[model samples]
Target: MANALCDTRHISYAGCVAQTFLFVFLMSAEYSVLTIMSYDRYVAICKPLHYGTLMDSRACATMAAAAWASGVLNALLHTANTFSLPFCQGNAVDQFFCEIPQILKLSCSNSYLREVGLIFCSVLVLFGCFVFIVVSYVQIFRAVLKMPSEQGRHKAFSTCLPHLAVVSLFVTTGFFANLRPPSISSPSLDLVVSFLYSVVPPTFNPIIYSMRNQELRDAVRKMMSWPHFSRHKLLFCLYI
Candidate 1:
């Protein structure tokens, strides 16, 4: 972005804003998927007996709202720095996207406060929240494992495995990219890591959900075949 805008390959202000919004969308998508998966785990483990009652439509809607709320808050905070100040002096952004730190460097204004906000929010949401979720799932797995039946154990493992994988990969790469290593902070590295984070959620989410869910597949097949079966029955009734 910095290079492209500096050499007139692309514009910088809009580039930064676009990058921020993309991050917002990605985070929102991740949070939505993870929250629903968490609730699914919650039902499968914590409230096995009353899973239907607890995780009905309303509960799912609430979880989605919470996830979207976080995304909106994050976007608002990140974007505030972009349009808040006049950056006509030097508007070169040194990353593929409009990240707070990289954008702050080009600002002719003081960036101390923005830097602090970025640091705090990064740890609070990315690391802190993820750690909490990991700990919660650990307890959930322990509880699920205590069930005596083989069928129950298989089900529990299937439900929890995909979430654990996604969370671990997300945290590891995202954290590494944010650790502020001088070498890795270059525009090239930033672009590469940005792509990695951007591509991960969409690629892995469907695979995880589909592979882990056999019953959902069966149900779809049955629904599709039901119409055919009904037509056959009507023809037989007319003949009889």
Candidate 2:
């Protein structure tokens, strides 16, 4: 944003490193949180009786801490490994952000194989988390299907579907952005894919969740009507 406003594309070495670390950390943490949310939904829908006991405040706090810790560890490993490489190629990055793949493009050494290996391992971990989410949702759906009441099923679907939509959007876009074939890669395509995974999910998440909340919707409606109501009251007072 600062660069765009200033009409300059230059980023300092330290700024690049910071951006890389922060981007990876936040993205990793978001995935972890999403995984945890799947578990939460599973417990709520599948084992309602034990939900409180299983997802207690302490347990939630512990999981949250672990997620942040994993993010930090991931960021440290990728940032350290990536910036350590010598860049003989030009510093220009194809993507809008300081991502690992874009940074790897700037490296001109065989040592980049190390970072590639690390990325593969990271992908495996992320895949495991995705599988966990899938399994949890399967269980949740099964339980929802077993419910006798139509309203109950509808409520369960309503709660779970938004989360599933968000997870699908996040995971699919990210996977495509990172794993797409090189033959079809271009600057514009990369930027668009990057925006989809990096920008769209976060931008939509709150809207998706808030839209499901009846109280929030009501509040928003009331807020929207307030100016009109105030104008009517002022006119009546002037006429009186």
Candidate 3:
């Protein structure tokens, strides 16, 4: 919109490249963290006895850091490969953002081959994490089934089901958006799928978690009530 606002339909090469890097980095980080969260849930549910030891504060922080680092690495690799290619098709980015797929479409050179390799590597990594999440859930389901109390099983399932739902939404939409055949690619379809995977999940994830997790629900309620509570406390102080 900056270009639109300024009546200048151009972005600096560096700015365009940076935006592309951020796009890849942020997506990679989100998926990596979600994968870690699935494992955290697995440890919490399938091995409650070892949860504290396995997912200590330090361990969680380390995992988070690793996720971020991996994202940066992936972004750097792809960004370098992508921009190294010549954009003979002109500077008019078809997508709203500097998306790799859209930008690659503008490349008149075969330099996109390197970027394709990076994309394949990224897909492999994502697939591996997807498999890990699936295995973790399978174990979690088995563990839940063996629980003696119905209420306990319900609680476990409730906590897990939302994460699985979100993951499925994210993965399926992303797969469709990114892996769609070029022969069938439509601008409207791309926009809708991109919005579904990239925009919708992040916006609705908190709602999903708050709805399903009692602890988070209570926390949100407390936060929402804080202003009223503060006003009441101030009134009580004045009355006293």
Best by lDDT: 2
Instruction: Estimate every model's Cα lDDT from 0 to 1.
Output: 0.70, 0.93, 0.88
Model 1, which residues run further than 4 Å from truth? 1-9, 183-185, 213-240
Q: lDDT tens digits, residues 28-137, model 2?
A: 99999999999999999998999999999999999999999999999999999999999989978877778788889899899999999999999999999999999999
Residue-level lDDT of model 3, residues 90-126, one tens digit each, is 8888766678888998999987988888899889999
Per-residue C-alpha lDDT of model 1 across residues 91-191, encoded as one tens digit per residue: 66665456666666665767547656776765676655676677778778788778889898887777788887887777677677667678646668787
Model 3 off-target regions past 4 Å?
Answer: 1-10, 213-240
- Model 2 residue runs over 4 Å out of place are 222-240
How does model 2 score by TM-score? 0.91
Using TM-score as the measure, which candidate wins? 2
lDDT of 1: 0.70
- Report the poorest 10 consecutive residues by lDDT, candidate 3: 205-214
